[model samples]
Target: MASKQHRLTGTQSAIYLIISITLNALGNGITVSLNLGSALWTASAVNLSHLVGGDLKLLLMLIGFIAIIVNMILLGGIQWRRAINNLVFMIPFSILVGYSATMFNQWHLDNLPLVLRIVLDLFGIVMIATAVSIYQRVNILLHPLDDFMQIIRFKFFKGNAPIAMWVSFIPPVTMSLIAIFISHRIYAINIGTIFSLLFQGSLVGWADRHVFKTLKHQGLDKLMTAKHQ
Candidate 1:
């Protein structure tokens, strides 16, 4: 019952991809603004930005490019098209993150009480996990961080989203920890970060099963083929 992936036409898939991207950016914006925590990758970028003191969006894009190299290593070869696509994916995503964060900052989300912020942060994580589920299934082009999970999920875990998601988190968590060690201060690791580490994988798995159940993972055979190349 869970294995059959519903097919989406090209247009349908594109629409889903767009929706997921927007949802992801909005969630990221909220989490970053609230300072309650963020998805691991976003947290890593944020902590690194505090240290580096540059544009958050550009820093995120740089981190995204680095992730592309890691993804290539996982795939066992350079996937030029996939790499290029992943790079392109960052442009709109980073812009959206910047805009969303700006909008939320105007709303003063960070000024809210701790309990309210925590609840909103958790909701933001849900949006991010849902976005990951939708876009990974679309499999057209992907954010490199999510692409890492997709490769691990299908190539190593045989479509086990939870395991793959957990596996994918290791790098970002390490990145965040290193920033903390160097700065001797906490930046982005907070309640939301803890929530994501514990529940994000399971959340993605649940979303894959329930959110847009018709949109099955696309190009799995090609991914399998990429494994040997």
Candidate 2:
């Protein structure tokens, strides 16, 4: 009974992976193409690009590697399996985000009015939050940063998703601030960012309760129990 609830089969894992990754890409694509405001971490990377003079792709990849390091710290040891899974997820997800951004740009989403773009940005955040909820529960492969959030949620915050997510923002928020201080310019910080900062994690928590309520977090037992591995 409990095993059945916790078990996610091969087919189920594949299905959830496809759905979550696609949704996440589309959501992030909307923000990147529209140039409105991205989720905090991505925004921080963009802001830092102003000062660092590197490809956005490279910066994002670097940010992901940093996430793995942070995840290692959170887990209290180096978990190579999780780190490799994160990289595997990151590569494909990054590809999808790039292609989706190109498609959105081709569709002229970037031309929308500020008001409409703002609305779309909020909607994009919704999609992202929902994607995070789905993939976290799927527990197959996750974005390292999302993994970081999950670790925080269960490990420190007693499974409080909102507070965990808010805490996870500290590093990226610091990156953005440092970049802004050095560059004297902003890359992506707007109403949409404010909305995400205030509500993205809450959105994730809401999705956990309201969207696909039957999907248990597969593999959570090992994750939450393994003190250092």
Candidate 3:
């Protein structure tokens, strides 16, 4: 029974990871398509890409690498193994996000009616919230920026999730603002960015309590705890 449970857990974890990645990618695509802007970390990456003349995916990867290094430094030592594991996830996820954004942008979604674009942006935000909720529940190695934020939250905020989340927004938002000033154009910070920052945490919390609660009741929550013995 334990063996079977372990296998089931592994499968579920894989599924959850895939779902989170796909949803995140789609959400990114929506933001790109609308030319509105992305979530905080992404906004910084996009802006850097604009200034540095590289693919957004590469820029995101660079940012993620720097974040990981900073995180390790703050923790007082480097963990090479963990850093490699984080890169393993971050690289593929960045590629998918970039590809999804490119494909969606090619559709010229920004040309849609204003109301429709707003609706789609809202949908994207919801998708991102859902993705984050699932990603947290799955308990896998997180993306680099998320891992960095978690460390910061625990280390400084006494593990206060809300406070950590708000604090985590500062660096990325600051970077985005700096990039905007340097470029004299918005690569990825706008009204949508404001809405996302204000509401994404609430939405994720709701999903954790309601959506994930329902999943738990359905026995899916076992997957969250089903690691190898």
lDDT of 1 by residue, 1-229 (tens): 1245556788898899899999999998999899887778878888888877778768877788888898888777778888888878878987898899999999998889988988898999999999988988888779988898888888889788778888888888887788888987777788999899989889999998899877777777656655422
List residue ranges in candidate 2 displaced over 4 A: 1-4, 225-229
Full-model lDDT, candidate 1:
0.84
What do the candidate models score in CA lDDT, each in turn?
Answer: 0.84, 0.86, 0.71
- Regions more than 4 Å wrong, model 3: 1-8, 49-55, 74-76, 154-160, 214-229
Clashing pairs in 2: none
In model 3, which range of ten residues has the least summed lDDT?
A: 217-226
Worst 10-residue stretch by lDDT in candidate 1? Answer: 220-229
lDDT of 3: 0.71
Residue lDDT tens for model 3, 1-229: 0122232267777887888889988987788678776788888878878876789766777788888788677666666655776778776776887798898888889889998898898889888877776765564656777667556655676444456667778888888778888888777677678788888767766776776453321223222232222
- TM-scores of the candidates are 0.89, 0.93, 0.77
TM-score head-to-head 1 vs 3, winner: 1
Clashing pairs in 1: none
